[model samples]
Each structure stands twice: as structure tokens, then as C-alpha cells.
Target: MKDKIILKVETAGTRVDAYLASCLKEYSRGYFQRLIDMGHVLVNSQKTASSCRLKEGDEIEIIIVNKENKIKPENIPLEIVYEDKDIIVVNKRPGLVVHPACGHPEGTLVNALAGHFKGKFVPYLVHRLDKDTSGVMVVAKNEKVKASLVKQFQNRTISKEYIAAVGGNVSENEGRIEAPLGRSHQDRRKIVVGPLAKKMAITEFKVLSRHSGYTVVAAHPITGRTHQIRSHFAFIGHPVLGDETYGGPLKIGEKSFERQFLHAHKLSFTHPSKAKKVEFSAKLPKDMAWLSKKH
Candidate 1:
């Protein structure tokens, strides 16, 4: 039988993960974060977030369950664009988590694909887009396709493009952000740019169009890293609209718009079989289209 522990918070505003770390001092914060991700930790009798703030007198429940996490295939819907015997391309929607990780193990795109393919779907993540970042991505059905796609990405030959609504009208029509990114020593959750950071990170952007006071820009990432676009833009003092993590400030975004106005616009890759270029595209989502054209 498993054991359960209950804790009461004496103060408010301590994050759920922080509180749990205090009670279970034996576990590392990263482990506590993993516990929060696996749904083992609950707040107020409901499944809440690791970042969730606790109020005084709030009750927290913890069950010492096994440390294994398995991805359960759930029957969920998916927006598939193109497919061959070797690979499948999906028009991933915003808020749709791509794979099972962190707090999202089930109800992910993988789960949906697993259900759609009826256990036949093999999920080979060629690349990743953030949970909130909507875009087009390809999944390989076999190892051969996976290896080819992975090589293309590693060689920086895959042609990928994105459109984003930023907080303000940028002065330059085009520019590149070259910075080294690595895990922040202070806050482990975020990536930091410094000379001590890892490999050269680069992003190229061109103003595509403007609307309703927000600038729609095309971003071509020469390198892929966690939150690269969001972080790089924010580093330049213009964060993407609606991305609170790296977003500068509320007033800054409100001055132009709301919502992370980013979209995966286009992708192109070389097919292993035909040795030809295959291209895919997704239209601008409704949130970015709510406003009329300005530029």
C-alpha cells in the first residue's frame, strides 16, 4: 500500500512546487517539479499547476506513487496535412501539446495520432515546437525516415519559416539575432544568453506585414533551442504578443495587441525517396486574423 501526506500552507503566494519542496525536503526541486508534472501532487483536492500560487490555509495532498510514467494512447482528434508511407505531417493547433513530457503526458498530439493510427503510428519527433506555439511538423513512421529527417535538421538544411505578431513595429525590416543559449544558472527553468553558453544560436526575421498596430514578421531560426524566438525577441526589447514567459510587459503588448501572435507558416524538406523538396504550410490562426490589415 502507498502512503499519503497532507500539508497546510501557513502563508500565501508560495508556489505549489515550492511548498511541496518544503514539506518533502528529501526530494530535490527538480524531482518535486517532476512530481507536479506527473499529477502526483495536488492542490486543494484538484489537479493544479506547479506554478500555481497557494493561499493560506490551502490543503495539499501528496501520494507516494511509483516514479514511472507511461504514455497512454488516447483517442483524440488531429489535423493531418500530408502523409506518405514513411512520414506524416500535422497542422498542430495552439494549446495542443506535441508529445508527452512535463505536465502533459496524455491528450497530446502523439496520443491523438496513436489513436488515429490505431497503435500503428510510430512517433519519431524530428523536431519540437512549444506547447503554445502552433505550427506544422512531420512525424516519421519508420526508422529510415526518422534518420533522414533528423540529419536534415541537424545539418540546418530544413527550410522552416514562421510568422509572429510582435509587441511593436520594428524599425529594421530585417535582422538577425546571434546569441549563445544555455540553461540559466540562476533560474533553471529559463535559458540564458552569454559567452559561456552553448553553441551559436541565430534567428533571421523579415517584416512580412502589419495589422492593427502589430507587426507580422517572418522568423527563420538558424538554430533551434528552447524558447529561442520568444527569448531572442524579448532580449531585443520586443517580445512576441501573448507570450508572457519572455514577454516584456503588459503595457508593451497592450500597446500593440494581445495573444502570442506567432504561427508556423511554412516548412520544406528533402524527401529521402524521390530526392525532391516537399513543402507544407499552415494559414494564420484566427487570433492573428482578428484585426484588419495595416501593412
Candidate 2:
């Protein structure tokens, strides 16, 4: 089905992509850019590039070409942290995929949310966490709220904190890793730093405790990138414990570990409905907690 929307710009000078992202909170900037690229979005009845700046009172028409629904809702359980009419914050457990993809076609958090919501409202992912990385995640119930949260993330106004146990002891009590990241030519699934890196990535960490040969630390990623924290730590020679993809140790101090020791402990963002700052957090899972005790 196609949904056509026409609006007259009241403010000038905003990029078309930015304007669309702001107005359509449910879709992402990337989605909007894709639309523009496909000539689904037009300014004054003429197709325009996503980077084109808008002029006041310019008429914009957007043709939303929605994809056919393919994902099926499942009866999977969810650990909801916070919920409102606009958004839902969930404490995602390890081993659960955030969304359905190639290998995982069902039983994802999206499936759980779809079942939980029961089609009363649409569930849109604001961000994501790795399958093995347990943490707090927020989902938007409506497009407006989703757009607002997306802008916050793009502006770096949202704050997030993670906890990870790295192999070997870290020398610095607190440090920052500012490096560019890019996909490895050698391994398509892995990421690399330095000249091999093609995108800017930054991560900061403060050591929490040091174990026999491991260190637990709080990590803050200034930029959201695929495997940023894991790759950054690995680049620094302290790969996350149990992260097999990044050369992390599978066993730490006689304990058999199964997954990456990375957890999203805290997330803070401005509420779209309430227009106020809100923060959410989740405790470490059993394995990470046990690891801390051993350390």
C-alpha cells in the first residue's frame, strides 16, 4: 500500500532528509534518504536530493512505499523495564536476537513485542544490541516518538553506559579509544581499526575491578557502530571475555564462559511524549554477576 503525504514547509533551510526524519519519527534518516534516492520524495512536485535545503512554504510530497509484512509475532517472553503509550524499555537477556534476520527468522524481541502489543500499535526499534550482549533497549510505539529518539541519538544527546569483562588486566584506570572503524577485508563479519577503519568510532572506559587475568570496566561509546566496544577493546589488546569473534578468551580464571561479557547497564534519553529526560538501567545477568564475584 502507498501512503501519500503532502505538507507545506513552515521553516526554511532544513535539509530534506532532516525534515522528513523529524516529521516522520517512525522512520529513520537512512530510510528517508533511501526514499529520496528512489524518487519517492519530491519538493514542489520535482524530485530533490536528500541534501537539498527546504524553503519556507515549499510543498513536499512523500510517497511511503511500505514493505510487505514478513515477520511473525511469537509468544516469547519479554522483560519490560518501562512502558508508556509512546515507548517501551526492555531488559533484554542474553541469547535473544533483537530482531529477525537471515539466520534468525523468528523468536526475536520484535516478535515478542508484536505479540505483547497485540497489534494495537506498531513497534519500532530505536536501537539495537548484539545477541550475546544483554542490556536495556527502548522501542517506540509510534513514529513520532521514534523520530525524536533517533534525532537524539544522531545528535549524541542520548547517554548510554555498558559493562564488559576484558581479557587481561588493563593498565589505565580510565582511558578513551578514539579510532576509525571499518569492515575487515580479510573477515567480512569482523571490524578493524587504524588505516583499515573507514568510519569514526570512539569509546571510553573506566576500570571497575581487576581479576587474576581479567578486568571489568564501564564502557561508554560516543558513537554507535557495529561492534565498536568489542573491536575497540580488541584493538587495545584487551578483547572482551568470551567474545570469540574478537579474539576474546573463552575461559577466564577456571570458569567456562559462553558469550561476550558485554552488558548495556544504563541508557538515558529525553522522553518524546513527556519532553523530559529519562534514564533506564538493567542489572548484570547471572553470568556477569558471577564473574564479578570471582574477580
lDDT of each: 0.73, 0.85
The regions of model 2 sitting more than 4 angstroms off are 1-69, 292-295
- Highest TM-score: give the candidate number: 2
lDDT of 2 by residue, 129-181 (tens): 88899989999987789889989999999999999999998999999999999
Error of 1 at 127 (Å): 0.6
Task: Give every collision pair in model 2.
Answer: 25-143, 25-147, 26-143
Cα-based lDDT at residue 251, candidate 2: 85
TM-score of each: 0.71, 0.78
**Tens-digit lDDT string for candidate 1 (6-56):** 455656788888777765555567777887788888786688788899875
Model 1 clash pairs are: 241-259, 241-260, 242-259, 242-260
Candidate 2 lDDT score at position 204: 91
